[model samples]
Target: MRTAGLALAGFLAAAPAWAEFTTGDALVIGNARYGETVTAFGPDAVQAVARALRLRGQEVEQLANGGAVAMQQALDGFVAAIDEGETPLIVVLSGQFASVDGGPVLRPAGRETSKAAGLSLAAVLEVLAQSPRRAFLVLGEAGEATALEALEIPEGVTVIRGPAAKVAEFAAREMAQPALPLEKSADWYGLALSGHASDGLAVLTHTEVRPPSEAEQAAARDRIALLDETAWQRAVESGAFQAYLDSYPQGLHAEAALQMRDGAPAISPAKAEASLALDATARREIQRSLTQLGHRTGGIDGIFGPGTRGAITAWQRQSGTDPTGYLDAAQVARLAKEAAQSPAPSAPRPRRASNAVSAQEAATWNMARGERGLRAYLGQYPNGAFAARARVKLSNMQRGSGQ
Candidate 1:
């Protein structure tokens, strides 16, 4: 299948300094020098987009045929630069986008194929979603509308997928004029491309495009109400706010949740001192490191629950340190360093057994009746003496039930 081209354009028109796109960040990428199938107009499209963005008083980062590392670095820098909520982030990608596992993947210049050297659309969206600013993504010469449609874009983000034939033409026009407003540019491009029988132009925004279902809206409201409960007023921890945000990212109180997360007030001096002695974030990091090293802490939720403390103690014992549940800064650092050096633990493989069922297995054999019980028994002892019998019975039962 042929890879499609894409361009992501973000606009923060609500900013006070927005004088027809006087300030914003633009990343223009063109990957034409691919070892495999390459878009001939990719480089030209990138240059054109860069020129247009520059004319709009936007700081443009133009990369032509840059490989994966360079692209990642540029994207990271762009994301970091979007510190201010008012600043817009625009990304113009003029490269081959291959569909892999029902998702879009960007093919870099040096890669033989997108599967071997492509960036996932999910990763790109994650980077864009990090920015608090409202983003507008514009795709040029892109296909796979299904993949794009499947994306769960954040609340303020917008997407515009342009027609494949008109992508190069639009870029060329922008290069020549450079003063056209983004909306006008999109409109003109859409109009020109509408004549094509295979035209696939769409204007997508989270608000104007994808609306939440009634169930989803109700859940969001419930989460917002939970956040507004009086229990959180006295002790507004980062985790509490994070939980709320996780549940209702685009909720009515999303802005407030962000503020509380970013600017959480200091606790009392005594409380502060106590917390400093046992920093939750630090403890969570330690727990993660321990879990990665095969010492299960139940989970890494930042809460130093009994499971976490026990894990910490076990880790301390293994490291030849005093088995203190609490981890000091130095101890945490040491644990982190050790964990980094150790190989990542893999999932446990199922144990192989003989065909003969054991005494314990025989004891549970009577309980193994009906669909659920038989399935549970088979799961526990797949290689048991009655395994074949169980399978035949299960299959017959399933077939009889029309399952």
Candidate 2:
């Protein structure tokens, strides 16, 4: 598939002095060089975008027919630019994403001496970690599906790709729409954003064979509505892309789902060690709340530190709240209430009387059982309607045998 192009529009008002935007700080490394192997898109992508966005003060750079080392140089240049306090710098690569042994390799030009150049997702992540700024990526006819699949990015980055044949068309599509709102749109799998870029509303436009039908539009609305917490939870549990996309497509909640999908690592102790810079009022409030919750978390400490996260997680687990370590608004409110309570030591809820199981519940139970056999069945169906009935029937059978 062809990669998409961006056509970001200028803000009506000049961006604040703090904001910086660079659309063409990109290097195109393949095909277009005179002595390189076959070309994918023309070598003029960098120049073209540079000219288009030059008025906006974006410095465009091109690395034509670059080999592996050349590509590294370009990447180093980009890093240097950002280190020097460049606010917004975008990187676009058009070539082949080859699945070399090192993961996803970028096959730059000069294949005669330079072996297939591959840049794996891990490499990309390293680049991102080097700078605090958000970034965007555009892959134009870069790789096959296998290679493309390996190019994962961290949060605040975007990626877009399609079959090599459609790359030019996709690029055109991206150009017409120029830029989509990073915060508002679903995570751009093939695009990256600069952390301090001006907040212009993203707009995309393109001609298509047909407009979506009314039924299709309604179906989409229904699907989006289904992307509630339940659907998201289900997708995470299943770890299936289809299950995920079925609920949330390219919409507002997609990024959140993707974050979950990307498997956010547990916040490391090192990260947690940094004390939250809380004001006096916040510290006092937290301390008071902790005392009320019957926790001796070593005094409120006036900082949201390891002790606070532990307390919050423990409270959440005990209160049937999602045990995600981070406390959001809803969780915070509930935690505040828990702090006020002098409850019995946290324990599991008493079993309910009703034994009636919904079809949905049954389906989940069956899936669990299939995954973990008797253990799964017992764990999920504990004191459930079926389990309650089975217990009673077993007791009756034992009594009859004794008689």
Candidate 3:
């Protein structure tokens, strides 16, 4: 009974090893010459793939400027090199997508190469599908989406790419500013690469990740944190997002995650208006709105000047209410009503004491919030109504701070 059990366990252990193929080499084709035009973007992308794969212990055969004939030869060589019995096989291609009737073609080498022989994504996937070996296909430039859509990723093979525009733009930018030769710093575009690789063990690119560096990991972490749930699902489903959240659950996005789990309410656009203080932009917007309503709330510069408050008061008066000068929900409503009723009147001069009261209130509110540059705010609009209150709060803060 013990011998039989041991034999069964041994077979189970050997089963997975036999079921998968694991060869350690790579074929990087950046076929830029489609019947003889230099394709800089495709070649550049292929070089990037070659460098990345070489670092990962793969024997790399890089073919540049090869049109269709050259591409076929390389594919044949690749097949010959890998033992069908092994597990993982990686094939990366970067080139223009040629639409040939119904099928998509990867433009290959030579001036005379027919546009057709360049393998379609479907054709490539079909060839890869023959063996249960794990395969990785990267369609860098044109037809990326169409190819991904056309090819059914064999159960063991993985397919990864973004839209053609995104891939092309990224490849161009990466080539323009190639990472420092062989530098493993995190800034090597590792973050973006990690984001792309989140779905599975996949090709690394400048947009997906920096080559391999400390900053690369940091950038990757930050990028991962920023990924929305839908994007996260894509990565997780692909099986490539590394870095355990439990290891650094309280990392940069810790706050965002906590907020999400806490069921934080979605901030409405209307609420954004009320949350404003006397920031430059906020002041300008308020003044503009008030001026349009005929309240003439000061100059258009973002300072909440006395003119703005006076306008608020007039708006309040016109609407049958006491003018509190400061903008609030009620004030906005009154101003909107007056605007609807008649054409805007000329800008009015400030009322004595009313502007001062409003200023004081505004200052008090600022002090309550512990906003910096209160002195500057006061200096700009000294005659505000809440001057006394602002002064009191400022003194209290100074005292508490032991200043």
Candidate 4:
């Protein structure tokens, strides 16, 4: 019953709430219970999927371990609200599934394995048929998709079948970065990707969305960072990213501080690492190696803004791989090896030291992954720009995932 229309704003940052939105709803169901036969399924994966969807401004119907009655009601409600346009739509069904009539039906918890007790998969697929271009059906780990060939799935609706965790990952990691090649993505996650837009289009990220009003744009100013605005502006104007960070490590512009300091675009890399969990040092190394090979990264800093990606694209072209401007593990290794054998194209760029602090606050906030990292951040900089936001985020990540 949660109408999460405006929950897409940056959860942790004191940013405006829901400035843009993809029209439509997502139905996410996770059933971990099946009496004594199956071990109790956790809500973690489903919840993660819901959170990611919400962060992307998708309204989600998150149903956890619903019984027969609950399942029917939720499904009916979600299907009832659908419109057959180019609206973003997602449905994640995770749990035990029963195959009857040579088709799959979602089975309720407990000893009931009968088709009468099962929810028809065709009903869900039928709804998906409406907006094939903007729809996705992720068959999560538990209820393995069986005999899908016989199911006459429509052309546009993408179907991804995989573990619940991977499904969550597709939602969290891949959906937003549609440019990331899906083949490698599916291979890494062991997901069987299909459907209309599955070949290339990032259905969720690519789906058309309504932009916010001018008023909403004006309201994007950080209310929490009012005090730090003057100082932050000074730092940026003087190109003293480090200096400003040094002075106000906990300032509102902490993360932005670092990006401005020496990196490329002020792109935050924490939440959107494109599924490649490279740390600052690792990213810098890649940049460094690329530079040695005459690929300019704009700077040797870790941030992979347009410059770095462009360099990557160049290298990919030379190496005879798809020039995605992105890196995979193999590509990363190859780049490193090539760099080692090749001579230094130019001397290592001197690290810029224009005084720094505020950006560190951002680094702490951006780098913190879970409760432990957040707690550690709080312990070090209790009054940092994102401390309070981190606390609230941990308490409730759905709305409080920090910027």
Would you estimate the TM-scores of all the predictions? 0.38, 0.36, 0.34, 0.44
Model 4 residue runs over 4 Å out of place are 1-20, 37-41, 84-86, 143-149, 176-181, 206-403
Model 2: per-residue Cα lDDT over 198-233, one tens digit each = 465342222222222343344223322322322333
Give the alpha-carbon lDDT of every model: 0.51, 0.44, 0.45, 0.60
In angstroms, give how far residue 161 of model 3 lies from its true place: 1.6
Candidate 3 lDDT by residue in tens digits, 1-403: 0000001123447542211111244666665544424444454555565565544334455555454544565675465344334334556666666666547777654443465766666666665565443455655664343543444465655554544334434433432232222122222433122111223232332221213234324422322232222222222233212221221244333333334334457533222232332345655556666676666653555434345546767766776775555455655555556556656556553222322235555545444334255465555545453333335335434533446
Q: Which stretches of candidate 3 lie over 4 Å from their true place?
A: 1-23, 34-45, 99-102, 109-113, 130-133, 143-148, 163-403
- Model 1 — which ten-residue stretch has the worst lDDT? 201-210
Q: In candidate 1, what are the lDDT values of residues 1-403, reduced to their tens digit?
A: 0011112133653432211222456666666655534554455566566655544434455555555545665575455334334345666565566667746766666534545456566666665564433455555544444444455556445555665446656654542243334456667777221111122312211111112224334433332243332122212443355443432345434455566567657433223322444445665677778877887764554545445557878988988887866665577678899889888778342222222246888666556766787798888877554454456446545534446
- Per-residue alpha-carbon lDDT of model 4 for 1-403, expressed as tens digits? 1121334445486866543233457787777666544432345656677666655545456655554655675676466445335367788787766667847777765444565666667888888788757777877666455645455577777777776666666766665453465556666788887766445565555332334333322222222132244344445445555544543456555776766566755455321233365766897899888988988765665655555767999999999998867677788899999999998676545322111236776576556765688798888766454444455434433333433
Better of 1 and 3 by lDDT: 1
The lowest-lDDT stretch of 10 consecutive residues in candidate 4 is 218-227
Estimate candidate 2's alpha-carbon lDDT, on a 0 to 1 scale.
0.44
Considering lDDT, which of the candidate structures 1 and 2 is the better prediction for this target?
A: 1
Clashes of each: 6, 43, 45, 16
Look at candidate 1 and tell me the lDDT of residue 149. 48
- Comparing 1 and 2 on TM-score, the stronger one: 1
The candidate, 3 or 4, that scores higher on TM-score is 4
Rank all candidate structures by their TM-score, best first, as comma-separated numbers: 4, 1, 2, 3
Candidate 1 local lDDT, residue 299: 52
